[model samples]
Structure formats: structure tokens, C-alpha cells
Target: MQNNRIRLLMLFITLLLPGIAMAASNAKENYGYYCVQCHGMKGNGMGLNIKDMSVQPRDHTDAKAMGARSDDEIFKVIKEGGQSISKSVLMPPWGDTFSDEEIHDLVKYLRSLCNCKLGG
Candidate 1:
């Protein structure tokens, strides 16, 4: 009985460990997977596409610029795409790609990168 209980506990821990690790890395993982190509790994506007594109992507680490926008605005752009905010058509919509929770998490992660809040 003791051995069985130990084995079950071990199995539970093994299963739960991966989820915990994934949860912690979720924002970064999502950002890397989707945003990094255009936003860059460091959140700078100088992505690989910079040489190929006309308008530059927003630098996520720019506190001054990022501070002017509201969280709702950022969230909207992320969900509905830049065209929804009249910014650019290049920014594709991720509403179909990511869940609301994931979008919110990305917003929060952006805030962290900029070291600024939504509003002044």
C-alpha cells in the first residue's frame, strides 16, 4: 500500500510539473512563437523584417510610447489586429489564434517589458 501510494504521488508530481513549467513560460513562449519575428526577442522594433518592411513594428520596450496607450488599446490591437486601431494592416489579427487569457497574459508581459503602465 505504501509503495503504491508513493508511486501515485510520484506520478502526480510528474504530471503536474510540466504544467507548472508551461504556465510559468506561457507568456514568453507565446511571445517568442508569434511576436518575436516582428517585435524581436528583446521587444525592440528591429526585427528580421525591418529591412524588408516599410513601417517599423512598435518597440515594446519604449516606455514613453507604450505609456501613452491604454491597456484596452493594446488588448484591442492584439486581439483584433492593428487595422482595428487604424495603425497598420501588417499587424495581423490574433483573436482566432490565441485565447483571451493568453492575450491578456501577453499584454501583461508587454507591460513588464516596457516597465510602464497603460496610462500616465
Candidate 2:
């Protein structure tokens, strides 16, 4: 009976491991919570705050431009804010708010949105 219970528990964990991992991935949730408002959910640069800003956010869907930029540049922008690269002061840094892993995953999400690889 004890061995059967342990086996059942192990099977349950194996089946749920993927779901648990996916939940922990948290890229979509993080992006939606932190970036969608400012960068737009579709990544078209027309976010909620665009109307109140001088410079528009870079559209992640802009394949041409986004492809031109390196991932490191994107990472830097996220880490240092727009002002670091003279983009916009309104774009505050999220480096302090997020982990490096989160930022990297966000970058991958941006790439997926654009449908273009870096420097492509």
C-alpha cells in the first residue's frame, strides 16, 4: 500500500511537471503585467501611454527595425531604460524590478512577436 501511494504520487508529479514549469516560466504574465501598457500588447508601439509621450515606443512587430537591432541592445535598453541609449526618459529601467532570466525571456518574446531573428 505504501509503495502504491508513492508510485501514484510520482506519476502525478511527472504529469504535472510540465505545467508547473510553464507556470514558472511566467514570460507572458510578466510581459502583460509590466510591458503591455507601455509597449502595447501587440507590440505596435501605440501603448496606452503613447499619447502622453514625446517619442513612441519601438514596435516589437517592426520586423525590419527590430531585426536590425542586436539582442544585447535590446537587453541593455531593458536594463538601463531608454535614456541610456537616448531613446526616451519616460521609459524607466526595469533592471531593478526583474531578473536577468526574465529579461532574456522577454527578449525572446519580442523576437517571437517580430517574427525575425536578431540582425536578420
Candidate 3:
């Protein structure tokens, strides 16, 4: 019975790993498509649009800054625009463009970019 449980657990992990990898890949792709223009390819906030913009984009790679924000705050800003978080108006609302799951994925992606978490 223990061996059977181990086999089941292994099977579960094998199936789940691919989905997790896919989610990460999709998040990266989404970032490239929707965020790279302003956040930069490296998430350093040095996109081409900066030259014409008044306010600078937040650097996703800034571990200190990103770590200060909670996951919910990130999701709200991404979904409802920066104004929702009392930030720049230039950050447009993407609620219409992405579903809640996609936004959650994006939050995770942002966390990965910063390589930090709240209070860390």
C-alpha cells in the first residue's frame, strides 16, 4: 500500500510539473507581449517608450521595491491600472485584456523577476 501511494505521488508530480512549467512560460510570454514595451526586456524599466514618457516605469528587477508590495497590490495595479494603487496614470488597465488567472500569473512572474517576496 505504501509503494502504491508513492507511485501515485510520483505520477501526480510528473503531471503537475509540466503544468507549472507551462504557466511560467506563459507568464514570460505575456510579460514580453504586454509589459516589455514599458518594463523592458530585462524588467529594468528602460523600455523604448521611456524617452517619450514623463514618469519613469517601475523597475521590476528592483528587489527592494517589488518586495515591499504585496501580491494583491501587484494584481490590482495590473488589472485596474496604476491609479488603483495611487500610482501613475500611464499604467493602463489590463482587466479587459487579461483574465484574473492571467493577472495572478503575472503577479507570480513579477515576483520571479524581483527574486524577492514581501518582507524579504
**Best-fitting candidate, scored by lDDT:** 3
lDDT of 3 by residue, 4-119 (tens): 99999999999999999998899999999999999999999998899988999999999999999999999999999999999999999999999999899999999999999986
Writing each residue's lDDT as its tens digit, candidate 2 over 29-78 gives 88788887878988888789888887888898999999998899888899
Quick one: best TM-score, which candidate?
A: 3
**C-alpha lDDT of candidate 2 relative to the true structure:** 0.85
Candidates 1 and 3, the one with greater lDDT? 3
- lDDT of all predictions, in order shown? 0.89, 0.85, 0.94
What does candidate 1's lDDT look like per residue over 1-120, in tens digits? 999999999999999999766754898899988998889989988778878877899999999999998888999999999999999888989999989888888888899899999664
lDDT of 3 at 97: 94
Candidate 3, pairs of clashing residues: none
Model 1 bad stretches (over 4 Å): 1-24
Colliding pairs, model 1:
none
* Clashes in predicted model 1: 0
Quote the positional error of residue 7 for candidate 2 in Å: 14
Q: Judge candidate 1 at residue 60 and give its lDDT.
A: 96
Worst 10 residues of 2 by lDDT: 19-28
